[model samples]
Target: MASFQNINIETQIPEEILIAQIMQLHESISKLESLRPCKQVNSLFTRLVKLCTLPSSIDIEALPQEVKEMRDSLINLSGHAEGLLEFEFSTFISLTPEPFKNVTLFPYYGNYVKLAHMENKILKENGMVNAKKVAFVGSGPMPLTSIIMATHHMESTHFDNFDIDEKANEVARKIVASDAALEKRMKFVTQDIMEVRERLGQYDCIFLAALVGMNREAKVKILGHIRKYMKEGGILLVRSAKGSRAFLYPILEEPDMVNFEVLTIFHPTNDVINSVVLLRKPKA
Candidate 1:
């Protein structure tokens, strides 16, 4: 009986073997998401940490060179996860800047760019506190992803989408209405934000994506509406392709706008500039 117990203990797995397995898992995740490689790899590594905690007999020091290589990949992937998210968001949103759609500079694409930046900024700043009742102004050419992410954060929220362009409004409406996550909470309206200022006060948060390059007068007018629509203690977020510091001058004076500001200026991810401005409303 003693001899059998000794044999069983000796046959147990080694820590080194477990580490090698972890490395392979990380590599597999990296391969899955070529664009979001780092995040995928990190996620795999996280899972490996859990697996390695098992009471195994593998020797940690016996890991092969290939396993070491995997460790290197994990480190590199973890280091760049944030940078990758930023780049992905920037390139996706402004695929088509103001002007002719076919222009090479303004390549029409999906809604990830705008949605990613806005969601990232708002979540990081507000920390998901009282994130209900969202209002989106100027739902742009593609705001499906933006509205979708917003619905995820807000609790039992209502989405009010306001847009002046009939075609743009239709596109956003179709996108929102089609999304099961947003359809229950979202409402789309084809109305100039300026004309609907009085009706906007009900929302707890407001999003303004790509309000740049419009006529200067129009920009100011829209800002006025945003100021009116945002609730006290709510949040107002803005994204722009130009990404300049001058973007916040128009609405800074609203007495209710929070003083702590978040300025996000990321390098062009694909071919588009990524700029974001986040302002929280005062609690009073």
Candidate 2:
């Protein structure tokens, strides 16, 4: 047998470091195995990265200092997979929605809570059931959350639900129709938010859960139009899938006295999905 070059066992890492690296590798293997191919959604890669690399509350930058010795043994995980797109390369991925098995509103969560927590927070704070008016934009399945929350105490509030998607509008109508408490208080409409400027400021409070994707320019234009319907100090509730202070800053900087406040953040444990961001438009 050929004599092997003298190996320096002393240079080897400690056992704990080796174990941590192995654990991280196992996590990555599980994630890759669990990933399914789906084409309908745009954020698939970002979702995959989150699922593969992060825990619900992981601090991405600092590996537990205790485990740092094994750093070289593990892959350095990035926050989201889209980070890989800076280079001109393409990779394929897939996603599909399985039937959601467990559904209920609890302190932990259900789809409704994912959708409604923002509006509920505001209503509880303002004690605004007596307030004359309220509006909802994009009254999808989630608007029911707001309607149900409003029904709890508001006796004489006018609720308007608006949507441009026929499918969404139809679904909202059925949900609203079934609710006796909400029937007198709520109305559903199929219309674009931009086209309804004439009725702006007609409500004391407005709820917006519209999808304002990556297009910051469009959001700015829309906010400018929203100024018309809001009363001098009425509140505008906003929830979106995308949250960037930089994108929001331009609209908020407009000459109008309208102010923005963060209501609450309802981030889901599902990393492959976007967290919900809630905001308020202040009259001051």
Candidate 3:
């Protein structure tokens, strides 16, 4: 952790240098975790948090593996850090320049493409047609998933983009407005999921972004809330990373609190690790 602490957050460091620092810290942290006292572990967690809270202008692709490992460690060591990381990632995406804004940096493009394909496949398999109403929780600054769905489905689908970040909502609106087709079909809202609980049941499909809530408990609460409001027979598409990549974006397994029937599991055909779980609200 001390090796990572030497990084100058104020300056724009080269990607290679950052990666090297991250590797060193990762090795050291892994070796010392068992021997270090709780105080030392907490101190390392604090340093990692500072490293992760990089300026939004930095390219996420350039982010080193050490930073990702640190995130996983933080979640394992102190559950409270999940919220901090979520906010940090949201801020990083929100500050992305218009020209470079896509689903993510180029390395992650395949993930979104695979996600879009999985979404379409699930909708078709479930016999869902002309899904007129859709909602995306944690849509982020670009709302690329919603944009893709709208483009594929054309005028048949209308999307509501929700996020707690006002700045992200503003940017998402601009991204939508830039495309004439998307501008008419999408709406951005700056509010928590609980704030709009009353209207959830109206949507034919609801997308849960990988980083929607602060922690698993919060996520479970969100799942329970959605169960209460989602229309019977409606589809819930959850995006999650598989295995170790789950550190970056925690996976949402089937929660014990919800009674949703698993409709399908779509795996990525590309290098990306994310999979989409299509869940259906059973008719009671």
Winning candidate number (lDDT):
3
lDDT tens digits, residues 80-109, model 2?
122232110111110112111111222123
Score candidate 2 by TM-score against the native.
0.50
* Candidate 3 TM-score over all chains jointly: 0.65
Residue pairs with backbone atoms closer than 3 Å in model 3 (clashes): none
User: Per-model C-alpha lDDT, please?
Assistant: 0.49, 0.45, 0.64
Pairs with steric clashes in candidate 2: 37-94, 37-95, 38-94, 38-95, 47-272, 200-229, 201-229, 201-230, 233-283
TM-score of each: 0.47, 0.50, 0.65
RMSDs, each prediction?
16.8, 13.2, 11.3
Model 2 alpha-carbon drift over 4 Å, by segment: 1-111, 123-129, 153-156, 210-214, 240-284
Backbone clashes, each candidate: 13, 9, 0
